[model samples]
Target chain A: MTNRRKFLRNLLSVTVALGLSKKLFPNLIAFDDYFDDDEFIIRNGWVLLKSDLDSTNDY
Target chain B: MIIDLDTATKNVKTADYDVCICGAGAAGITLAVYLARAGKKVALLEAGGFEYSDQSYDCYKGKNTGMEYWGLDTCRLRYLGGTTNHWSGRCKPLDEVDFMERDFFELPGWPIQKSDLANYEAEAKSVVDISGDFTAADISNWTSGKFIPDRYAISAPTRFGDKYRAEIEVSGNISLFINANLIDVRLNKELSSVTELVVMDYGKKRFTFTGKNIVIALGAIENARMLLNCDTQLKGGIGNQSDFVGRCFMEHYNINYGFFSGNPKYWKNMKKGLSLYTDSQFSLEHKIGNGNVSMSISPDPPTGGGRSKELRKYIRNNVCKWDEITELSRKFVDFQCPGDGILGTLMEQSPNKNSRVSLDKETDSFGLRRVNLSWQMNELDKRTIRTIGIELAKEFARQDYGRVQLASYILDENAKIPVGYHCHSIGTTRMSKSPEYGVVDKDCKVFGIDNLYIGGSSVFSTGGGTNPTFTIVELALRLAKHLS
Candidate 1:
């Protein structure tokens, strides 16, 4: 029971650390909301997922 | 001195010279300058005086039975500068492969190799006022590794009359005759050497000009016409013993087909590399089709808010609202509007014997028989163009540079290809090693004749995919050197 509690505490600590980093370096996760915009994905030099080109999420 | 035979005395005395060049075009004028500099007494004769006139241009009128062409009289100007007065000044050397025979192209290859003209290219450049080197490496090094190293440059389009007239007027050994038309090329009793040239002035006065050597430096059509009409002595033609004088007509074919869209990131670099009139070449390997293709990229103009019919049609078809598409166009970089952007093409026509010029019953003002030009193309031309288009599209997709949308005509083999010409008529008096294949020999001398020679693109064995003026000047310089 103590080991389980320690693992949960460690996982929560990493999550909080990442959350704090989001405020300091926003560019890393800034595009998490635009997975639907093909132009935005292409503009950022990322390949378009097949699902992005299709409307029904075929891929 | 530049003298007009039209103003000469009624009984003009016959003049004798070392070298008499008939037709003062690019080739004749260039040869005149070279020979005169070597201290040879040169006589340069031009059909027209200083500028164009309707009477001089009337001799160019003829029939075009096969392809749609610009009016015969409208295509080549017959003034003192010849057709260079209207030249666009695009100059590129013939590629090495163009001088060799390829099985894919019909009757391909030149009797004289590119190395034969190599020594004279620099002088040809100076003559044409091409100030820059045509090495592709000298251009932008930023192309996406797809362009072949076959670059071209422009010229100031040095009109020989405007540029060399002052020197020709002052040169003591050179004489320039204006409004002197070559009426006949009379040969000796043995029919081996040219005896004299019968020249007619504008006022109907005829005079003889005898020389040690004579050169027919007229343009392609006129060269064939002059030879074919000289049947008074030779039954067929002067060099028509083998009947190859007016065979194998060729020209550079250009068509506006296809669109290419590029990424906005490399838009600036791409524009710099593929600017207007910049020669960027690409060739296909054996696996695909061994043909060369060149392209010129241009920007699309803005079309929005009822400004374009295409946008209106798209709106009606629900492709997109005009405002939405316009906004999208503004958002994307280097987005090519339909019918805009890069034009990829193959300009070299396959040499065809059936595409020829023959004498018609019609006669010009000079009493010479008119030319019946049959400008024809074949299935190979269509197949080559389609293959080039497919290869270009594949390359663009493979390199991730852009997307190519080919025009419907390029995709459909049965599509009626337009017969419009690029105004580069070539290969009427093609050069060959044997008289069986061509009219002129490797040295551009008529096969059977001893003293007569031909100049201009008429002697081109195969018209490579570039302007012929630069090659014409190079060959003229080489011929002058040989004669000297």
Candidate 2:
């Protein structure tokens, strides 16, 4: 637990941690709660969990 | 690795190097370390720096030594670590499914399989520090039924250059540079052999690096872009017959953001398992019917879904409002998704000749033409993504374990759209059995060109719907051992 926490702290600075953290924490993480109200998707990469799975930009 | 006067000359330096490599990113550096460890002279030429030495390939990724040059979510770095510097380090091996030639799709499987690259993967594990024993049979045995307890897991993703930085630096035969950038590759009059590698510094100081053997470790787009730029002697570009040089460009396609509710606590699974499996690749085992696929699963919520049921209840009942009930329920939904986070792919397009990178009139920091990326998704790719999306939703629904929802397609074109760009791409200089079909041969040697080799994801013949780092490192190590 101690080691995992340290790893998480390091990972949070980068975006990969968002997905990785959710994977590690499962139900414990709420994306809405992690950041402040000022936070928007522009400065942050969205967790695209339900909106874009069907659309594609291949062309 | 000095920016001496002869550098602008390309491939005819006075230094004594047993091997001279171009593009000092992941594969080039790995090969450099191997040659050095084996007591051979090695000189590496990089087009960028330890991430910031040259501004051309910077992806705005702040330095984390080993991860300094990790490939970013939407950009490529022409810097020291190659693309691995910015990579998410989510390593997984290419499986038998990824290796099988999909007759259903116009693709050819690799001559080797999960078994062929095992030893290299072992070495890769060491190169990038991570835990977990990656074995093919272990993954194969996962679904064998009664005797097998579903211990199905995957590969450990580790950043290669960061993991092996110290080893590369201390080696006796390896030499690395921070500011070196490949400008032009001077070839012989025959236009078949690479005689000199012309490099330039941020100061415009030209350098020409020469060696008996040379390698191109530049990433997929840059590899082809560089070749196409070297049109001084070769018409139609070097090794560009059949217009194959910039053809068949591909990448893994991943479109996320679909919802899946009704799983009660399915959110928990996606979060906890992100770090659970450390195999070579992630696939659903039976994803081929929809046209060659690989997968990973995760909960819809962030920070993992372990306490999802509890958190959802707290947010819904205790936090505040009856009006926000729908929003809270949306949070409780059990949708799961995984992607190459930075260049997170939800789909991988088949090799198409049209999707390519070509030179535009606009120049970059080094006065080179800005590489104009022409990425096009054919109907085949769109059809596959939609088909696979429905199929996967069905599987998640069929499991009786979770509900898979598809909504984005239900909206109008101008509605919330999802752009599935996995930028973890391959091809441009593909490998095939012969020169007629590829840029490199079985050993990653560019066809007809003796001593010129290409490693990294750039040489990939097909883009299986999975991250290519594990496979890239494995191939680098294979080249290392082969050259060692």
Candidate 3:
């Protein structure tokens, strides 16, 4: 559980940084590393699956 | 005249007072003064002396069965001024929406509307030493559409014992008795009215007084304790035939919910403790209770700002891998953030039947039962706090004002909520249109009991997000007029 959380937290930071910087630097980075999977995304702080995020639109 | 129960018991005549009020705190003193000015003879009783003492405060000791809470003896003051002796003096009246019934909440709303108490605002302000308009347009303009400014008027925080001591001493119609604890209440044969009030001092010296009307102005917990302890006449307690005397106990849910990184320019000009509340429409749309967030600007911004602090808190509380922590730290170094501020919240807790005050088996020095406070919160309350954080974060992001990083407990539904209270005990003797719903009526009179009234936050139908002193004074003023 601990390792899984760490992996998720690192993924969240990278994803959030990419998402935020995407508007300013659209082509600065390629989306191939982790964006291949469309199921997982970060909203606010939680790492949610697309279906779960849609159901619990907390924000 | 102020009389010490120790030496002056001989001078106190036990007959024919127009009004007898228990607990010479804010409500008791307020009611006494107003009724005295209206030409009514009043007997005002104080369980404690002019100052603090261990003997007096020991009565407040009680058990907490449901939730972790501040020690009851320490949360409230027992002296003549009551808890106002140590209050921070933040004052705001309940909002209009606080009185209306909402589909999301289960309890019955206030019997009286905000407009009904508007007539006493001026007098209440005078009593608390607050002047000028409570809300500022400039503060309201700073917020986006989702939130609006909510102002709290600072008071000299009038100590009723000190502020009204001279007036009470000079009043010919008002008799102030210090160290007089109300131990027992005797009702008529029909149990329709309180016939006599039996008071005792620390020495166990007893005295009895009779009045045409009686007002129980003890603070919230004590008021309920008093009613529940007077079981000699009524089985369940006086005016408790419906078993509503000590139910629906409430307190303003105070906690630090999130952190904000606000715009430096806007933050510099704003007051350090300015509050912003969720707009009424937003609250209704979100199906959440009313909420207020007070900003406390950090004197020195942390190395990584509010987000870093939030992440650090989360990491400290939850199990996280070292590699993920290092990556999160590296991301923070890459992203420069503005100054951070802490967001302290005061959210309204929905009234729950289980949150209540009951009589404990253990007796105090005077043989009166101690309060057993079971402070409970439901799913609605938890949701309200979480929704307020989410809404605030979204609003800040929308306006470019800042970003809000919510506390970890707010993000996880299964996490235990940190227990916090504002010491604003309320709703134990709630008012309603009828006895089937509450202990008191619209006039603060006990249901089914004539000439017996309640004054203070105990009669509050709902504990809004704001402090209760202003409303307590307003209700006392309204009750005084009704009694007169």
Highest lDDT: give the candidate number: 3
lDDT of 2 by residue, A1-59 (tens): 69999888777755574565457534323232322323121101122223233535211
Give the alpha carbon lDDT tens digit for every residue of B357-458 in model 3: 999999998888898999999999988987787667666655545556555466667767786888889999999988887999999999988989999999
**DockQ comparison, 1 vs 3, better candidate:** 3
Q: Rank the candidates by lDDT, best first.
A: 3, 1, 2
Model 1, residue B424: C-alpha shift (Å):
0.9
Q: Please state the CAPRI-style docking class of candidate 3.
A: incorrect
| Least accurate 10 contiguous residues by lDDT in model 3 chain B | B330-339
Q: What is the TM-score of each candidate against the true structure?
A: 0.79, 0.69, 0.83
Docking class of 1: incorrect
Q: In candidate 2, what are the lDDT values of residues B336-431, reduced to their tens digit?
A: 222211111235567666777666676666656556566666656655555555444444434332443344341222233344555586877877
Q: Give the Å error, residue B427, model 3.
A: 0.5
CA lDDT of B364 in candidate 1? 79
List pairs with backbone clashes in candidate 3.
none
Separate DockQ for every predicted complex = 0.02, 0.02, 0.06
lDDT, candidate 1, B137-213, per-residue tens? 33343444434545677888788889999999999878899999999999999999999999988777887898988
Error of 2 at B26 (Å): 2.1
- Tell me which of candidates 1 and 2 scores higher on TM-score: 1
Candidate 3: stretches off by over 4 Å: A1-59, B137-143, B301-339
